[model samples]
Target: MWLKNLNTIFVVGYPIFVSIIWITGGLFSSFYRHRQSRKLLTADEEPFVSILIPAHNESDTLVAAVKSLAGLQYQHYEVVLIDDCSTDNTWELMETLAKQWAGQLAIHNLHLPINQGKASALNQGAKIAKGDYLVVIDADSLLQPDAVTQLMTTLLENPNYGAVTGKPIVRNRSTLLGRLQLLEYVAVIDLIKKAQAYLTGSITTVSGVIVAFRREALNEVGGWNPAVMTEDIDITWRMYRNKWQAAYEPRAVCWILVPERLRGLLKQRQRWSRGGLEVLITNRRGLYLNPWGQRGLLLESIVSNCWAILTAISLVAYAFQLFFLHNLSLDGNLLILMFTLNAIQFTIGFIASQEIAQLTLPELLLVPVYILYYWLINLVSCIAAISSYFVDPQRRGTWRSPDRGL
Candidate 1:
């Protein structure tokens, strides 16, 4: 009876919980958009911004990415390119670019002796950054023409906003995997962020692809935590804990390359999952204390972590029963219900993609494929993350160059 009740929670409760979050996200997103349309964003003066591009074995795409930012409409900004001990010719290329675009672009280059991970490199850059705001950009990210202006303007508008993250549009969508990821980013990531921002006035993770931070807030939180794998996420929570606020600027879009192969995608997802778990584990005290009304955010984290664990256990038990007991019968209603819930989610995602991502009607035809691909990949990655946590909990958060789909 206990086993049956537990299975019911996994099969039914999970989907119901997901539906609530998605629906809430949709409603909140709509409200946010409505409210935002009424406001006029006027910039009295442009704040000095420092763009921090951290690269590690990113030679193939670094130059193009940097070039894209050179055309940013924002006038008062400098680019600081940090090569985190790249084994390849990344630093050499950066040095060349710095010399060439010296006057045109106030570009500076920094090379590290050893690869101490992205967080450390960002910290070193922050120490020397002369701008009032520090904008972190991934080496493979192409910022939109007005990305800098949009980000800085948003930050300037609200002094409470400690950091602002831009919308990351997947650029390389030629392959099937890339296309699926594009949909995921738009339908899933984009919508959820909007909703989270509206409901809690906070988001789970800041898009590390391109995000701007005020120097004051950065100093208050002591910058990025090198101990965590996802420095973006770590810093976001830290900002909240320190009485600082973060916001999402959907209009400030940054084009980024997503993993095109299954292996690359899985590795990326696993790392994200592991990082999320690490944050939740390390910040358990914050959840109980509920300082500054962070209980909602903390509760969301706890529920998500529990859901992952429950899902893993449920899957293993079901598989065991199926192999041992030939009498095992699949729950037809539960399967149908799951599919129905997923269809509802796909519809919400489709609507969001159309409005925010500007995805055409023809592109909507790939919804089913995306649903299957992402669902399966996420499940596998969840299991892998949980396994990694148990097996190597004490492992240091280190840098490993992901397959850039080059």
Candidate 2:
């Protein structure tokens, strides 16, 4: 009876409880944002921003990214493109763009002799960057004209903020996988960030693809950690440990490509999951000693990992009951309640994100599929990440160009 009760609470009760928190917090955040006026900076108030693009074998997508940067509405900014010893023509492409936009924009190119990871390249870029504020974007990302302006304004307005992360809108929706990711980004990823910020005054992690960091904060936190699987998650927690706040700015938008294939998507998710797990392991001391508000974020991460493990175990138990004992104890009502909660969560997220995301009716119809995909992918990735961590605990943070959707 005790075992059954434990299973029921973890499998059904915990998810419902967390979902409600996310939905309530997300709704409140949406309304709050709607009421607030847009904050814009005057010419004198604008700060110089150094935009860093770290590329490793990103020749295929680098040009378009640089071109998009050229059109940024923010005036006092320079572009620093770092090629991390790519085997492809990424270096040559960077040089060409530097010359092409030489007179028009303050474009600078840096090339590494050996292949270092993204974090190392970023550290190098920061050493030579002239701006007081640094914005990092992936080589495959296309920044909206007002993205830098929005990120900088939010960071500047928040006197205690160490870093600010923007929303990443999926631009590749041509395939079923891509469309699923699009909904996941809007309904799950973006909503969770807003909810986390609303509830705890700090976020779990920043979207490294398009985040702006204050130079002082970066210096205090020792910049990015190349040893971790995900530098973004590690840095966010480090800043929090050192008494710096991290914020989420939904208005700052960046169009990005997602993997359109299952293999690529799984790889990406596994890397993300591994990075998160690594941070949790490395920062476990903070759970007990950290006096800041970030303890909530750490507790949430622990709950999530426990939930994944329990969910996997429950699935296995259910299969055994069905096959060997010819007994299935699944509760129909509990399943219905879970589904209803998920539907409500997605509805709230869609409403909050529709304006910026331009969500369509057809995409709305994919909620059911998206829900199943979300659970399954997260389960598999979480399990795989755990296995990988135990197998190779000292894995270096190296990356390859991800599958850009066709």
Candidate 3:
């Protein structure tokens, strides 16, 4: 009876396909990014750039974020900080910075009557921007002095490149949770970003931490959709569809403060996962029209991620069924052996190969814990997707809070 049902469940429940999708998709991306990173423009061509930062109740960290930009190696730049009607001192803080910099920094403060989202603030900033290039940055994020120079240099040196994503180093790596997030950050943003850069011309979300776009591209794409929860992702898809190319020049570095606690990290990840589902769904037209979209984006995205969620969920459900409900039966030894072999294969074949240098023996020893975290994050992503299903334009405060630096 069990072997009979195994056929049905194996077809539905076997998560091997999920691993294959991620691995192959990841390999393509990683290979492409490797080549791109190897080839870069050595010549220096700095274009005047406009930095658009949206702030909301960021008084605690806004000044540092703004001041950090002043140190940029690329001197031709303007800093426009939008105070998106914060009840906090973020506005007053920006006022002080504006006064201190005076003529040295081209600073403009647009205080919204009420709280609007980051997209709206960015649209307003882009309207009055006085530069050939525009960069969207988060308040809590700080660009390295050379980050803008490298990113803008990529655009100036290569006219074909549409946008560039800067390398983001975790700022809060003090606590164990922070350290764990830091590792996760490397795995996701650093490693995965490299893959996207290589494969499919669609590097979906450039970190709000630091992403630069050509003025023409941003204007052509029409600023950002105030209604789009993840305007960053929306713009990327539009850019790709319009035939513009995006690049990942890791030389562009930005420091960002990750959540110190697991719960805070969960909220941020949940927001991103939910927001990403919105992006993938919203751009279904572009994905479907192109044949590669089926294998590359739509089918791969929906099927692969859905299975990842199901795998994590099923593992727990089976445990409950076997222990409490006594509704499922299996060879515990074979099952344990099966997972142990798969775990070893996955870590050594992939995780170790990619993160070996950074993930020490002790860190590698923590793979089991990391897997739990990974599953939790994926489950949260599914929840976020479910949430997006119910709320199209989910109203969660202003879309992009003022850069008071959260």
Tens-digit lDDT string for candidate 1 (101-132): 88789998899998889999999998888998
| lDDT of the candidates, in the order given | 0.81, 0.88, 0.66
Model 1 residue runs over 4 Å out of place are 37-44, 291-293, 328-331, 355-362
Tens digits of lDDT, candidate 2, 242-334: 888899999899999999889998988899999999988888998887755578888888888888888999899889999999998877787
| Model 1 lDDT-worst window of ten | 36-45
Task: For model 2, state the Cα shift of residue 68 in Å.
Answer: 1.3
lDDT of candidate 3 over 23-102, digit per residue (tens): 45556665654576443333254667889888787877777888888777777788888988788788888889999988
Clashes of each: 0, 0, 11
Higher-scoring candidate on TM-score, 1 or 2: 2
Q: How would the candidate models be sorted by lDDT, starting from the highest?
A: 2, 1, 3
Each candidate structure's TM-score, on Cα atoms with residue i matched to residue i, is 0.92, 0.97, 0.81
Worst ten in a row by lDDT for model 2: 289-298
Q: What shift in Å separates residue 103 of candidate 1 from its native position after superposition?
A: 3.9
Compared with the true structure, model 3 gives a TM-score of 0.81
